[model samples]
Target: MTVVVTPLSGSEKLRLREVFASVQDSGSLLGYIRTYGFVRFHLRVAIGKCIDSRSVSKLESFIMENGLLDRVEGNANVHRWSEQTQLEKGDSIAAGHMSELSGYTRISVTQNNLQELKEIWDQWGNETKQLFYGNYGNLPYLLDVQIDERLFRALAQFWNPAYNCFNFGEVDLVPTIEEYTALLRCPRFQVDRIYSRAVNVPTFWKKLMAITGMSEQWITTRIKEKGECKCISWDALKGLILTHPDETKSVDVFTLSLYGLMVFPRALGYVDEATTDLFHRLSKRVTSVPAILAETFRSLGTCRKAGAGRFVGCAQLLLAWFYSHFRLIDKVVCRVFFEDYSLLKDIIVSTRRVNVPEENWIALLQNLQSKDVEWRAPWMIPGEILYRCGSFDWVPLLGIWGAIGYVPLLVLRQFGLRQFMLATHGLTQSEFAYRGADYKKRVGEISSAWNKTCRLKGVAIGPTTTLEYVEWRGRRVNDNIPEPDVEGARPMEEYLQVMP
Candidate 1:
């Protein structure tokens, strides 16, 4: 079972040159070598450090001049000889299963260089950690790397759920003018070291608007017209922003992440006037954090661009609406509007991507929670949110709706009229006795009215079932209100003006 191996010949130089020519980026470098038959690059220890332009050209000419190309032709030990040839060409020497160093003297300098490389790596690692950039590399390299999921999670936050966007992460941090100049001067290869820590950071929406110099209004009109509420992903917004001339400013990843958190949801039309007002107040509060303000503006600009003008107005119009409308807890509404956003930090921490990073799912859940909190903040949930937001003119109706716990219950009756009731207990099929007489009392009155109407209209009798009170918008009508025309729902202002 002995295996005989062929050796490489100098004739393979052409093939090696072709393979090297195919190497594009770092990833391609490995792939090319593996696919292109036992190809490898070797450099003299002294010349390796200086193998650029002049030196490489000199070696190429030297190889071609020698009959080295013919010497490698179909030899039994060619592979072994070729391996040795490759080693001899570089600082390291190798043949068959053995390898030796051609330049042992450079070991001290190499050790020193190794220390310097470690220092640079450490510096980049610290900086990346500070910016909360995610670890990115091939599986083998990154598998052993300690990936702080916290950092990955934070980086994921900048993604806008509506738009399927991603933050640029560490990739945006290109070499500065000074860094580039140093790279050009430094002989020891530093390119790999510099780019190793690079990850993509998201571009904020405002940054995009700034570059395009598109007015906030134009964006809003288009977005609304497109009917794409929250459809613009943060990544798309970033790309668009970079294409603009005026707005192409470099921003840190953390700042952009914060910006996304504050603005992306708003852009998606998840915000109400009160929520908008809250953001405005938050804007004033985080003035020291100008990136926050920048993010807010960009988000608004994106929404405007996305055609969410209604939302942009909602953010600014809430305060005015508060002044004009006399509601009981105007102060409370103001308080809830300005509620602390710190809770989002906890939610962010708890959020997880099942397998792949899912930005939108986490965002929707967060938006739902935030809205629920905003609605409940005013009343302390000592009562109900829907009941309070309704602000119905009739106190008894509010009491009735509130007592029902806002859950719709359906019940079939022996009588001809269908009966529906609000239940504290949300719909359940478990057999249970009806203890409270009040619900039946309420049910009786509704049945009587329904029966009276049916008799007057001469309608058929059957086992009437409750469709659920949540659907009962008619109870919302009273002395101050007429039967809804069903033509079209009136605008908020007209509807409000018709009431007290």
Candidate 2:
């Protein structure tokens, strides 16, 4: 679905700020609360809950599923807590009283208490599952099944138990030139100016995963290398990738190189002195940076070993990435490549003739989203995530207000029920995309109060709009509205009038 930015009015900003803060305080926003304000502890807890003998077991399976886990040893896990403690859901046991019940019962192991400790899932009892589901407003019950799926779509990338800390989910894409153009062009300035939601986002780094079709290993490895450092120098980053020259290194190479180019002026603010200087020095040698970006992806596509029509996979990855931004990014992941390409009018990169069938592209889209990923609620909660005082194994379901239970999802925690709303299309229109099962009418009511009350841009995000590639002129074009140039750009519907 195409992402459209629904601007919020100034008074609406105040309302949203209040709503966001209040929600954060409420246990209802378990994901946001866990991720923000002393998040290291929470992330550590999330990782700790995931990274264990079970994680080790999972890693072995992943290595079999993927390639080797890693050649080098990853960072050591030194932060210690009692592995044998039983953490209750929401309720707490006194520190002094902890030792008294240790022998009686405790959630000693990870969430492997109910079933075999093979995977990350914890079994949920119907009654307890219903109770916790009600706590989060019964997300699926409250919203359409699509909303639940959309809410949790891209989370597996960030919260896999295998990699532990916020990580990337492997997209398993085949790569495309047009897709790369859309990616490098994702308007950072407009998104930053308009959408005031996520920090350290707005940059195209997250979106780059779609462009290069890189693996998550590359991302995690880069995370280890980059650490708290947000920006990277082309020389160091490109040098590291080129030097490694392994197939796997493509992940780090493709993701970081493009990110460095897109966020150029802001580079100095986030990176070290050496990193900033490298970009400045390199830009002198390069007349057209965008050309370099286009060429890079073209080369990536050619190198990929797909039988034929490799660009189809690349295009699909880009579309999937673009559609996901609707659920992931707070605003439209505007197809800024046209605008970005305009900035480099002097440089040009020619793409191969487009001959892939439309069905192939459509099929890839289905493949990326074909599977359903589900999780049990509150098991991801810190109450259960953190080690508590008694109870081998976490509970699968509540056992008379017991300690162990099933796991909840990070994606659902952050996006579902606890929605960050924008304005409706018109003064009277209510955007129904975020409307859950019971909340349809209320969204419009809230929007009306927005303008009468105060204004943050005062724009409205409409419902899910489809962004498919229609053959424009000769090249395959992907955008909400199609325009050859970023100036006076509009959706591609008019251009398709010429098509059959």
RMSD of 1: 34.9
User: Per-residue lDDT for 284-383 in model 1, tens only?
Assistant: 2211111222222233223323323222211111121112111221122221111212111221121222232223222322222111212112211110
- Which 10-residue span in candidate 1 carries the lowest summed lDDT? 104-113
Candidate 2 worst ten-residue window by lDDT: 103-112
> In candidate 1, which residue ranges exceed 4 Å CA deviation?
1-236, 239-387, 390-500
| Candidate 2 residue-wise lDDT, 144-248, digit = tens | 111112212222112211101122221112112222322333322121111111113323344333323445555334432244345434444544544454533
In angstroms, give how far residue 179 of model 2 lies from its true place: 11
Question: What local distance difference test score does each model get?
Answer: 0.24, 0.24
Model 1 misses residue 168 by how many Å? 40
**Backbone Cα, N, C clashes tallied per candidate:** 30, 36
